[model samples]
Target: MRVQLFSDIASGAYAQKLLEIGEGLLGTDQDGMIPFTQQFCHAVESEDELIEKVFPNMQQNIVDENWLCERTILAPKNETITKIYKKILAEINTETSVYNSIDTVMSSDDTTNYPVEFLNSLELSGVPSHKLELKVGEPVLLMRNLDAPRLCNGTRLRVTELGRHIVKATILTGEAKGDNVIIPRIPIIPNNLPFNFKRLQFPLKVAFSMTINKSQGQTLKVAGIHLGTPCFSHGSNHSAKECRTPVRCSICKRTHHSLLHPKDANSSEENKTECVVNSSEAGKKQQQVLLATALVKTICRNGNEYSIRALLDQGSQASFVTESTVQYLGLKKTGFTSQIAGLGGN
Candidate 1:
């Protein structure tokens, strides 16, 4: 159980938020309380020193002066010993909410088009607009309207493993790296599936393509996916980028080998010429093959739509698909003959 909890602490964006909080609570300039936090977290000589330091910062944030005087709350410093007190105090922090409706805490769950009023007013003097990732429904205690540079581009959506949800969105071709969203784990699947199975269990990371409508608005610097199996993903057709696949050959249209392999080309002379290929030439071929496989091929028809002809492909598998074979089939007289122009009028 301890290992599971520790792993959970390390995974996802939660650790990042904690680090930011720790940094803010300590001070801005000198790496915040990272060194102390790390030491406290690792604890070679026990957590007495670290807990004293970490808890006091939080206690001071909420506890009034009288509370400290009454001994109801102990002043935390870099020297105490009780770790449980710090943990409880940390868990009891007030959830953040927006004051004016312009940027308020999410009342309902899923939100859309919600203007990022708070985001627009951030102190982003040198930051690029694209770098910002503000989620409306994200739970955050409005950190005084971007008074400082934010380490995380997006809002904090507190998903209770048994209460809140964790939404995982992949960085599509054009999206900024590490950008994501979190929604309520409240399942909205069709009634076919059991809804009341349990409460608060978050969904596992679901690999999916970005919506086409969303892709229409942004200019992607880099695309994450390339050519996923045609329709394997939900938004495959709408995805701006292709899915990743094993590099394959161009000329042979083979998905197994990428560099033409020389030996696998069915033709002998072609292989010999390429066998002694220089590194530079090999690199160029690899690029060419990759491009050819990725880019959609354009085959101009003879304007004869869906034209067909008798094809005597004698033998189970004797030859390959070639322009000559197609031409011969088009010109053959299978009892009913017609003079049809080829692709290039040949």
Candidate 2:
């Protein structure tokens, strides 16, 4: 049941409502695995420098192995995984298996037939119609739940036989471990696309590594997380138990609640669970904070416009923009540039 709940959360069926509470402990109770993975990543970044000094035994775990360096990575959405798979394949200059999705043409009993170009132009389903690369020994993930125990959804697999019609994969996870399964073309309805339109394709995706959301119920002994942005899910960071050998965390400089040195007396319980947003009250507070904050906008007097993302710091007296933003916007400076003093008076 817990595993199913975790899978549901990963599917994002409970995203909006849960996301609201995800800023609180309720989200953690819903799905703790992804949050734990994220926290583990953050702790890795935070303990990078002090890892050797604070936890001598864990120092080697930092660079011992990296899974993200793999050629493929799994993600929650089929589209996302497809995109990542394509990108990695391109990066490695590897040849991918090209599979053209079947397009069914039908004329309604009372409706006129559409043109060939129009039918051809119609967008396909969630899965890509282009080349899909699958290599032997590379990790793969099942896109659908065909079997509960043997080849369930989100199951990790390794490619063994890539046939023209069927792709044979060995299960690398769960009770079906070491068992080989043949994957067949499955029907899939693309999200937000025409309801009547469907795509039939192999129910397999590359999974050399995966996004935190797609990593439900899977225990990761080692992880490599590249944070392009802040985690938006609940329990977005690693738990204290997961930080026994964290590798690269951004908060290493902060002496306050460093996870690397569990023996430290100053470490607060709250610090260890920074990603675990506990309590409805805390969730409400987070929403209120977001509501109160303003996104800064800039417009040239000449009617030139640009969109940008900026946080409104109510505590700060001065408004600021990054040099890159200014350059990108081509905003004219009213006067000579001056170095603004920060909190440290630099």
Best by lDDT: 2
lDDT of 2 by residue, 1-346 (tens): 0121222333334332333332343434454433543322333353233222222332232122233222233234444545444544443323456555554433253123543344445544324342456765556777666766566666677777678888887777676677878888776655554433445667666664456555645544443443434455666464434344333433554212322212223457655322232353445321111212234556755677766777633223346778898787777778766544332132
Report, for every candidate in turn, its global Cα lDDT versus the true structure. Answer: 0.27, 0.48
Residues 1-346, model 1: lDDT tens digits:
0001112323323333343342243344564223435423333343334334333443343233222211111222211212233343344444422221122223233233333553334322111221212222212211111111221212122212222223333222222323343332332121222221111222221111122211222232222221112323454332112424554455544333323232323446644323232353345432111111123232333444332333231111122345664573464324554443211122
Best candidate according to TM-score: 2
**How far in Å is the alpha carbon of 256 misplaced in model 1?**
31
lDDT at residue 121 of model 2 (Cα atoms): 55
TM-scores for all candidates: the values are 0.16, 0.42
Cα TM-score of candidate 1:
0.16
